[model samples]
Target: MNNDESQPENNKPKYKGKYRIDSTRLPAWSYASNAGYFITICTHGKKCFFGEVVQGEMQRSPIGVIAQKLWYEIPNNFSNCQLDSFCVMPNHIHGILVINQIREGDAMNIRIQEEDAMNRVSTSQRGDGQRGGVTGLFNPMLSKNSLSKIVRWYKGRCSFEINQIYEGFGWQQRFHDNIIRDEFALDQIRQYIINNPINWESDREHPPHPPL
Candidate 1:
């Protein structure tokens, strides 16, 4: 199996072309930098494996429970990362992630500021957004903390666990993301996620229902 936790040679995903979509990532931006990002990850073929929205509420399936749980666990795995607004819909998930690592350009100034911030804060007060010593910019494997790596770990882990009972569970080839530039944008995205379940019927990502 590959690092992405792909199935053994004997079993392969039913779908191909997961890598067909062109990347929407910014060329000059360093994904591991200090910033907030909005993320959307969809199940393969838009399957509603996560369960449905009922009376404007989300009812998670076994798989859905796993998805939501692991998302919360992200902060534990990546010290510099912290989750914000999050929701798991019938076929997809939406969340905001804040990376507190130093930005690439002007690394010196950023590192100094990061160090100052860390100094002013104590370990217990960091809450869910735990802050470690000023690091990440000097990480030997920079990509280790990059956004793509984080998402890959998340998707791969989810598939591995989900495939245990339901073999061949798959995710869309790539996820969609938007770098949140300001608090206004962040607030808007947060509300969108909060409202996802209530607005499921009209959501573009909503899967088609079978005829009654």
Candidate 2:
């Protein structure tokens, strides 16, 4: 046999396994900590259900508009997080999510503010199951600032709404993220999101697939 034929594939230095590799997260790094994250989420099978790019710009489809509206409202649902430099492509979305940790307010003051608002609201909506908007989430471990929780909520909410039109709309298995270490990296990511539409034709996510 030739020398190459006698070698083992597992002897390769970069080899992991036949099936999978390790996680992409940083060890001991808490996602909930105050930091900026660059995240990308794709549609199921890279289907072009969100919208199309025209003249170096993104023209929002009906479902894409819904995704945009809900994206800006993230802070309304979760007070500690804020969004920045977000864009919706034909089959994916790129955005920067910043976790504020929280706003300035003492514990007692915060409690008092919440109690005051509760009392001022209508008594008819005071109990659990009284409101249709409140639904239990499948992931109970979702932390306040977790990247997974934020992305999961966004994907779940978008799919729930978009399915009303497209029917059977779904998201890819998982998202990709990078931790922004400084202002330079933050600016770079922001510019990338801004230019995504302009660079759509050459994008790796181009030539989108059909329903999947």
Query: What C-alpha lDDT values do all the predictions have?
Result: 0.68, 0.64
For residues 129-199, write the lDDT of model 1, one tens digit per residue.
43332222322124457676788878988999999978867898767677788998777777777877888
TM for every model, in the order presented, reads 0.71, 0.69
Clashing pairs in 1: none
Clashing pairs in 2: none
lDDT value for model 1: 0.68
lDDT of 2: 0.64
Residue 181 error, candidate 2, Å: 0.5
Give the range of the ten consecutive residues with the poorest summed lDDT in model 1: 13-22
Error of 2 at 167 (Å): 0.3
Could you say which candidate leads in lDDT?
1
Can you tell me which runs of candidate 2 are displaced by over 4 Å?
1-24, 103-142, 208-212
lDDT of 2 at 140: 15
* Clashes, model 2: 0
